[model samples]
Target: MKTYNLAFKYRIYPNETQANIINVTFGCTRLVYNRFLAQRKELYETDKKSVTYNTQAKELPLLKLELPFLKEVDSIALQQSLKNLETAYKNFFQKRTAFPKFKSKRSTRKSYNTVSTSNNIRVEGNFLKLPKLGLVKIKLHRAIPQNYVIKSATISQEPNGAYYVSLLTEFQRDIKEVPSDNNIVGLDFAMSELFVSSDNQRADYPRFFRKLEAKLVKAQRELSRKVKFSQNWYKVKLKVAKIHNLIKNSRKDFLHKLSHELVTKYNAIILEDLNMKAMSGVLNFGKSVSDNGWGMFTTMLQYKSMLLGKQVIKIDKWFPSSKTCSSCGNIKDSLSLGERVYNCECGHTMDRDLNASINIREVGRSLLAY
Candidate 1:
């Protein structure tokens, strides 16, 4: 049996008192993170010394004494904030991410993490007990396994003013790898459709953002007309946020369903290792790319495939999948994006995406043979 961690998110409805406490916790966590970050920077620049989580954790009590408001919220959340700052620094040093920035109060998202200890965090009937905020009502749409241990919970408030808690749970399960057979498929990323599969299947993803673009624009225009920071302004702002939330939820729902179908149907899924960020910026395809949610779809496929003992293979991004003729294996000098149909001198013709998917499948098959 191998240990695995999974996060199950549920909508939570907290009483007014609990909601106020949660908001306080969010602010306190943000404050602690920013304060420690500034201190670390100043200390490093003046004394050529680095600060670690332990050093910051040690000073947390002193900070609470100075600003007693911090003591009113969950202590674990504060420690987690420090740990997050440490991780940010580590990631920056490793060249995995940019340097951490101070948290801004103006940011629409607010969240904090708390670890579970002594059964402090748990689900009872329709209520979830969180640290310092006991028994907030939860949706409980799905039941967690009895054996799975709750490790931590991340409480977040969205721009739409909805509360959610993501419970991180650890469990042990045996994953028997399925033998690779002929049940393999390749996918070529599509801007309009989500993907084109090797078997000529199209995801036909409904462009959620594009469809809702006009409504979002109208809402934003109305919001801009409102007096800034007034009650009406805030109400209009919530309306705008709700529209964005709708788009996001719709896109995620479609991607999840499609990924589930793909994972269940295929033993091995192949794709191109695409640089989506570069693609978005370089070609000025930001709107189209973002609407498709290709990156999110691949992430879902990866974890779902892993859990099911299936496999996802990514070929090199620079591979000439689009340029090469699938029928004769002839490589072309260049291919233009305008040409939706692929043509070769050898009298072979095929749809560009379909041809690419075929090449991707062949490459993946060859890789598996080794």
Candidate 2:
């Protein structure tokens, strides 16, 4: 049996009162996280020891007494904030991520997470019953698996005042396996296009930011002209945030659809292990590379392939896919970045990205054969 953890997110329409409560919960969670982070840092610096989660949790009641506003939100949400901080510290020590940083109220996104209890959390007709905030209208775009266990929910508020809840659940199930056959392709990342596959298929890159560049510039200029923190400034800020969120949403949607298609159609999918951070340092390509969202696309491909029991092979980053001739296997000593076509001494030639993709496919096949 295979065990899977999944999260399903849906848009929520909370009434004004409920929205206020959710915003307050966000503030309380942020306060709890920041306070504990400060405490841990100070204790470690001064005494060469750190405050653990339980020890700090014990101080929550005292702090709440001193700051009565904290009592207004769900207590469990505040505790979850501490748990998040603990996980962040663990990741840092394990070298998985950078050190945890302080969150800001000026941040465009805010969220609070809370686990489900037998009595406090459940799904009604069209509403989700959260701990403190009662039934809020939800758009059940898709139904959850009946056999899956409901674990926790995270309530998040976007800068445009839109709310969403993500449910994290777990279940045991068999993985869906695809037949191993010729339905395999190696993809090469391209700046002009999203990717070029060994089969000569092209996935076009959508320059989402470029599409909205004019609108963003106008909104930002309007925002800069306003007095900071004024009502008009807040309105302009929201406008800018709305455009940014639209670009993000569109990019994610395209990546999801494309990844799904690749996973469904191919049994073995191979790609080059690209060092995107190093590539971003190259002049004139940083903005285009960031806009392409290659990292997110690869992440989506990985998780989707794993979930469906498909094979995803990543070739070595240092492989000379571009320099070697795909047809004759002749390795050239040098290949310039401006070269659009690859030429070999053996009189074989091909498009640079296509030739790289073909080489990648052959490499993947050789690896799987062993």
User: What is the per-residue lDDT of model 1 for residues 1-370, given as tens digits with 9 covering 90 to 100?
Assistant: 9999999999999999999999999999999999999999999899999977897899999999999999899999999999999999999999999999999987999999999999999999999988898999999999999999999999999999999999999999998887768889999999999899999999999999999999999999999999999999999999999999999999999999999999999999999999999999999999999999999999999999989988898899999999999999999998999999999999998999999999999898877632
lDDT of 1 at 208: 98
Highest lDDT, which number?
Answer: 1
lDDT of each: 0.94, 0.90
lDDT of 2 by residue, 85-152 (tens): 99999999999999999999878889999998874766788988898888989999889888877789
Q: Give the TM-score of candidate 1.
A: 0.98
Which run of 10 residues does model 2 get worst, by summed lDDT?
Answer: 361-370
